[model samples]
Target: MASVQPKTRTFAGVALIDTPLVNAALQHARAIHDDMSFNHIHRSWVFGALIASKLPNFAAVDLEVHAVSAILHDLAWDYKSTFSTPDKRFEVDGANAAREFLGREAPDWDSRKRQLVWDAIALHTTSSIAKHKEPEVALCHFGIFADFIGPAFPGGIISKAAFSAVIEELPRLDFKEGVKQILCNLCKHKPETTYDSFAREFGIRFVDGYEVPSELERILNALDATAEV
Candidate 1:
């Protein structure tokens, strides 16, 4: 008897690019994120597919989860986002939004799949960890980082031309300023939520009057207390 063959997913360097879900996710992201972030999401998915192509089980990867995670990773960057919640990390806001979107649009998805997408978006900012999580989570993190900082992929997985093509399709528009503005908004509008993430340090460095105790200050205080003993 012949062995069964697993289903293989095709890659087009775009997340659900030709599917209705792509349009839906794009529309949803456009309403919430600035053009920069919207482009980031697009490139993130494409870059993620680039990363996925090098994985051991590349053909078996779930494109739906990848598309949802990439498209919604930064959905909460804007305060006006329907997914934005006060006093929660930006990642959480994006994760919640992804969950809600799936519930409404892809209600047939099992809880396990939903949770995978949620983790992918929620943990995209966490380093060393997201890279080790499930495939969707890890790939989503890699995609976000690769888009922002060239293809810093392991073993130089993707070729320059491939990366360039994705960039041409989705140009990164004023991404630096967009990131700065989003960080400022998070600190200024939702100061409480920035505490546990890099946004906290960003607030201290960029946002006026937004002060958090420096790591050096904390170390010095610890040393002073030890000397008193």
Candidate 2:
């Protein structure tokens, strides 16, 4: 049987893929995430997609994978959500959620597509790794950085009008404080999850009892068998 091509939705020069899978992913995100997070994820997808749409490797990007990954990038931000876990990193939670979502809602996506979504969401925050991974992962990272870093992001490749449109629609009300609040809450409650990641800094600066184990201390006495670097 012939495969159906995904639909492309474009407006004012901005384009996004529209499929049942992507639509379901968006709805799932909207239902679970608060205004700030929902808007931020959408902004990430737009920034990433806009940038990808301009790139030479644009053809290599899996639009649906990128969409779902960005839409569910911060699944752990809500501790009460379906993706929440007591002992996993936030990114891991998001990744697992994305993978599970794909499996349940898009069985035709195949393992590779689901894996791409997993990697994209899993590594969105780990820039050093994500940028070196698949185009979907790298583009997801780029979109996220674009949202946070704005016009100064790396190459400033995305068009100005598109950038403006994304922010205007999302309307970043308290985005900064909203992020701060989540990070600090993790420090206060899931401090172990905050260690050895970007959230560590928030814990150090904001949470009273949060502490990172020294590398040397871990060398002498560690938490697990995993290598520490």
Candidate 3:
């Protein structure tokens, strides 16, 4: 008998199943199976990487788990988005899928490591309720922050309302100081720069060009004030 070829899954203008597991997850999220695309996953990865770079003493193990989770975090959206707002259930579904896939394909990964991946996926989409005490949870929260910053392509605009929500949800810290530090680091590359610099460097071009919204503008202004003093 002749050998049979297995069918393949194509998504988001490309065949991503051949890609690495993390990349495949991103592609799956962005795939055209439904209304949402892998763009969201792509944005999450970009933002996650940037945040990971900035975090103090971020663990490589935690980062690896976060990368995997960020890509696969919304894999169940194709089914979940249809019924209701993509929420906790959606995350649980994705985590379950990730655990199953990882078990079959990455058997070398220990249970604890695999669980970290699942935990990251479960929490990445539920940042508001995430417990910062857990390193994986913090990494997941970082990925969510990346999503909010509009790192994804097309319609990656962070509206004032969205920014407000993030500020309210984010742990109370010296955000203005943090922004200033990030901005100062950014200015080293371009003397006259704005939020667009941050966006462009991280491949987060706004759909309508890189314009800082009013809320972000206020944040930037506060950062500038702190820097001047």
Candidate 4:
């Protein structure tokens, strides 16, 4: 809920909500590693949570569970490998770790809430499961997709050219209308075995014109430059 002054320029025209969950998640994510380099996976989750929080549908969703799940979805990355290529085993491993950590630290959490958090984390990466069965699951799926495919962050794996191509093909892409179609297909159709692989092989390939603000671009460029050095 507290606003931190941006060390860099902020996007003025964007309708973005920096929720407490997002802020907390960002802090937790940054603390997960000493490098301080941005984690696209974590960034994606944070961005997704931010967008979801703004929607009227999110109000009906469980905030505590979703927030915890969103923040900890990739906590294993803190202990394992980077987001460019995540280990499926490590993601499952991270879910266990996240549940343990949350259970210990967040004592007020009830069993149902805890299960929701765990289920959300467990399923965050996989798409084989149906979105309609669970509203939180659907939301988490949508949130992650929106963040990865949306224009909040620059320098994502999906290039501008590819993003354009995907948008152009959206009308023809074989699935139901909207984000659900993409998620369902990615989960059900792809035989790559893991979400990371599916994303690398197919997800990033189809995307195109996500509007990256100049300020975010500058920050991303600076970060990339810093990483290179």
Candidate 5:
């Protein structure tokens, strides 16, 4: 919640996380997201970059785009947002917000680049889809998953010391609670939008009388109608 200077991270003399544009995006994100979400975004970029560096053709990775995507991926979860609407999924809200910001500030980035950032943010929470997209998308998806669920892939890629250094810089204080609160708010304000999405589970668990029909129920109803026919 407290406004803090955006932290910087560099790789091979290239500014990955602290470029002027990235800092500007961070400023926008920080204005809405609390410290927990802000720190998580920073760590997600670092983690994604680390994974990207391990790829056979690492040169293809675009750090600037990745930084922007990771920074703005959770913007919809912010308590306050000028970009959010009631009917859209939180991911789409974030994707649209980032796209709008880029369109206004970096007109030269071209449509493909903007879509790359949009896909990474919109599909970051979707594992099956995001993993099949571009390397930037896959890295961002896995990086966020790794941060929340622990390293699920080849572990030796990131040394313990390196991991500790990142955590030291951006401490993960109250992140779980902060994320829970965001999910709760989504269910509270937009229960209809959560149906068939990841947030549905959170809604079912947190919101009173919030229920979606189970898959088995649908199948049984289909069978009963078939027997009557």
Candidate 6:
């Protein structure tokens, strides 16, 4: 579908890679996500981009891919969206859906570039791992982490002015409440998907009757089922 009136909301200056593909991706995210989730992801991108600007290594990084990845990082959080699957972890679901979006809308993007977006979205939650990946992947992770926590990054803090501007544009409206509801919804309906991911704790705490079998038990259960078959 043609992009609607530009919901891609990046900060002024700082050389944004304002392309149709990026705008389309942002627009798509705006359509499917709730206000809090939408604002969070955009904030993540802004935070990450600001960080990347300080590092000389990020010059070679593809900003379009990074923007798209950051914009749609939490796609499957809206579990009711068409992007979500019954059993896939939310990260994988979001990554797959992002690839699908690129395949359909930005056909000119090569497989490697599309996969870069997938890696960024899929690995956004894994700071330990995502940091070791390509620039796009690592930046997405850093951005999400910055927004989730405070913006006091490792090398230095993000500019206070920039942070304020982003927050002013995207006012966080009860972000924790919105996030808890989404996580609880995931646990309530797709408990299997939350079994080993970040949502597991949320499931245990928030979802009634949601069991997390220990690693040993999981292995034993598999082996026993195999023996029975």
TM-score of 2: 0.91
- Give one digit per residue, the lDDT tens place, for model 3 in 181-217: 4334333332223333232333223222333446677
RMSD of each: 5.1, 3.1, 17.6, 17.3, 7.1, 4.9
Error of 2 at 166 (Å): 1.2
Tell me which of candidates 1 and 4 scores higher on TM-score: 1
Local distance difference test values of all predictions, in order: 0.80, 0.83, 0.51, 0.50, 0.79, 0.83
Off by over 4 Å in 6: 1-14, 225-229
Model 3 stretches with alpha carbons more than 4 Å out: 1-19, 27-36, 57-61, 80-88, 128-133, 150-229
Worst 10 residues of 5 by lDDT: 6-15
Model 6 score (lDDT) = 0.83
Model 5, clash count? 1
Please identify model 1 stretches exceeding 4 Å from their true place.
Answer: 1-18, 57-59, 213-229
Clashes (N, CA, C under 3 Å) per candidate: 0, 0, 2, 7, 1, 0
lDDT of 4: 0.50
User: lDDT of model 6 at residue 25?
Assistant: 81
> Which pairs in model 1 have colliding backbones?
none
What is candidate 2's local distance difference test score? 0.83
* Candidate with maximal TM-score: 2
Residue-by-residue lDDT tens digits, candidate 6, 157-188: 67667667778888889988888889989988
Residue pairs of candidate 6 with colliding backbone atoms: none
Model 4 lDDT tens row, 142-198: 656654456433335334553343334222232223334333343333323233433
